[model samples]
Target: MAIVEVIVPQLGEGLQEVRVTRFLKQPGDRVERDEHIYEMETDKANVEVESPYAGVIVEWLAKEGDILPIGAPIARMEVEGVVEAASPVSHAPQSAPTPSAPAAPPREPVGVGARLELIIPPRTRAYARQKGISEEELRRIPAASGNKLMPEDIDAYLAGRSETAATAEYVDYPLPQQQRAFIYRIKRSSQLVVPAVLRRPARWDAVRRVVEQFKSTPNAPVHPSEFQVFAYCAAQATLQHPKFRSQLVGEDTLRQYPHVNLGIAVARPGDELVTALVKNASALDFVSFVRTLQSQIRKARAGEDQADASIQLLLTYMGGYQMVDAIPVLVAPAVAILFAGEAFPVEGVPHVNLVLTFDHRLINGVGGAEFLNAVAQNLENAETLVQSGMAG
Candidate 1:
């Protein structure tokens, strides 16, 4: 029979190799074409590989956690086209080979003078090797001798070398204890890869009207408060500036979703962070959006089944807290994030500072600024949202 080889599929940019996380089929097992065969773990996400042809599994060339080169043969399957010729009817008698005893296990290296194997943290090992420092060399470093290689050890090593020589050996320090994980990723990824561009001012008048209507509603289960109004305004703004509602899928590819999914950042118990999504924000009116947002928040806080949000825009209300302003990161796959800061009364006029951070790859500085302006313009005229309807 013809043996077919299976290989990992190309995932995306900056992806070199993927870890084999799971295998759905084993050697000698029959599999169908297009059936899931295995999963690979990439930096972007886990991807499943499918069998290309219906065949009997012959061998698996790779194991789990094995980092295979691109296009490397991972498995072999025997096709049905060819078969070995065999004698018919009468069978020939054969003698089997005697089984041998298993070989002794290899012994570990002995003596204190033996070379020490340094286990550097992930993302740092590659840098260490590039500097012509082997794990043994790292272990020999005075600072690294008594303890595991920390940031300080790496820093000290680079400090002694020429600036140009150690330029690429840097590693980002861990964030502060009180920092939010999302915030950290956003800031770091943005600084390294993305450019922050602000859009024009959006009208806030329409948003103001909606908030007033919610406040006037009697016995409203969903609080028609200022924060809820701001959320609705942001969603409606997305409906208008559809580009801001799109996500940067690739270097030049921008993917726009048909529905506007809104993510609301909520502080969970024990200072943990979670985002509650309001699906189809454009379809729902002010009150409906608030109710859905509140319900999702409750579910998230209760540790219920909250699904991943394919959100076009993330709205974080720091107004409830004391934060005045923040530049939030564009959560990958999401194109933009809107931050609504605390609202304060200035000379009898209530005004809130709003910031919309967008992926510059998809939306330019002028476009981002304009989108923010559009949101602001709507909020300024909040009457339209309230007059439209309330939560059912």
Candidate 2:
């Protein structure tokens, strides 16, 4: 039997790291070739990874909640080939070491008098070390929320220290893996590309009327919302506005997708942001569209899937909140994003603000404004859109 190393494969373009969420197969469990063995969470999606070898799992190099770089060895599998290699677990940076008795608590240092007990979690300690925070400095940092010193406390202390620094020197702290990935995309999509935003108001009365009618329907498939109506209309709008489904490639090229893969922003526990992607959203009938969108959103909330590059546009609905308007970020490979805010009475007419942020490299301000107008028109005709969708 050959002991083969199973590494974390590249899940997406420019994806450097992922956090292991769960393992479908434990050590010693048998697995088939191409069988899904584990699940991981990226910056914007949770995805299952398939094992390449048909083998018995020998050991796991990474544990649940561990964030590992791509191509890092995750497991050792005994396979049917003669491929021979030494066990990488001995020195693998991300390996899961054998379980042992918990280490003794760290004793408070001598000479320095600390006002409170030093209670630091393992993750927080690691974060402090990465920040070049000395043990003495950590001991002096105050914990605002609880007895335990959290990462946030370190951030707060650092912020205050920077503000009162004696010199102009700067300190760097490593960003969380998820945040780093998000920034990477933003840098590529927004900072590198020219992004333009346009705002317009749409009447929400029609949306409310249609939503109320749907709610009154006995045995309704799903309770409709203003966001749903807007999403359906936006998806339809993409058909008429091809540029909305296109993405800039090189300096002088654009790649237009055949279908509208709409991304809906979802906030998971801890306010972790993810996207619920609806593939070919423009093709589904309104009822099917609603069901599919709801299912995808549930999966995103549960961390079951991540948004990929195929998604051409994104929709962030702030209608449930008191927000009146927001400028949404345009993630890379997606040419545009739409933001909808809460409706308020304008001269006794209830209207919601819509902001469309688009990549100027592919869409001009005039085109962006026209697209926003199309979405607004769709919103104003919510009953017709809902009826057409229900008919399908």
Candidate 3:
């Protein structure tokens, strides 16, 4: 048996550190090699990291929310292999070894080695880089006001200047948990996904016909939003185009689904961006898809839980906005997302700007355009189901 160290691997470009957000396993638990054991949140993503060696966990050096640098060891394991020295343990502050010995207070002049992941704003980081001021230097200087050192703090540190209340304003608030998850996913989307956005004008005449029918019939139960209709079409298209239903699981690996989990964007209270899920959307008929989607929307508006992480395609509505096109951020695990704006007329023809954002690594512009054209063609010919009341 050998003792091995599992350390934090390099996360991504320009990233130096990550926070240990959650631990899936603890000391004494048997972990298989390549088993995910911890959730690490970098500046741009929150991802589960796998254990390198199959063995019982010996120690977990970092606790939840502890900021750790790349190559920092967070755990140790006993494996059946030739012994390899464990990665160096993180230098983050820990509790005292004995209760009788109180932990030493934090030191002034926080070391450069431990300050790589300091929380500084974009402007501050740029100014620090421009001024050749290290983040460690910021922590070394006594804060004139805020706990975090800022660009003005840098000036105060180097030039022997001071900032006043009149010239500086600071505000701090913790993000809501749901919002934080949304942000984490968005950052992953931006950093990891190679996005391709396609824009075209589509007229949802078939959708309007169905919505119009809903108005005439008293208590016409299913209120199918135009987005649902578009989603239904896109879902059907995914059944034909396997690429739209695929998710990038590795550098060159794609895991495609037999059916699509259609994700509908709904506005929730507290600035939370929730994607209400329609599970196995590709298997549903028009009416079932419509009712399920509308129900999800209603449940979401009532502050109910409907969103999940198993999204395959996203449908978002941005009505009453004037723009050339709106490109959606392709959420991770979902290769494609659709955006729709208000329908307007051009030369007596109704046209709605349809935008499709896809992961370029999994798909390309030609495939994306073909997919949108499929949705547009379905929307144009929606009268078959529209006249049938979409009851199927």
Best by TM-score: 2
Name the better of 1 and 3 by lDDT.
3
lDDT of 3 by residue, 53-150 (tens): 77898766555655566887676666674433434343346555887877778545422123223334456656765664443343466655655557
Candidate 2 stretches greater than 4 Å from native: 1-181
| Top-lDDT structure, candidate number | 2
Query: Which tens-of-lDDT digit does each residue in 256-332 have in candidate 2?
Result: 77779999988767656777999999988988898999899998888654667688999999876799989898887
The 10-residue segment with the lowest total lDDT in model 3: 110-119
All candidates' lDDT scores?
A: 0.62, 0.77, 0.70
Cα displacement (angstroms), candidate 3, residue 38, comes to 6.8
Q: Against the true structure, what is each candidate's TM-score?
A: 0.55, 0.61, 0.60
Error of 3 at 85 (Å): 18
Point out the worst 10-residue segment of candidate 1 by lDDT: 83-92
Screening candidate 3 with a backbone cut-off below 3 angstroms (N, C-alpha, C), the clashing residue pairs are none
What clash count goes with each model?
37, 2, 0
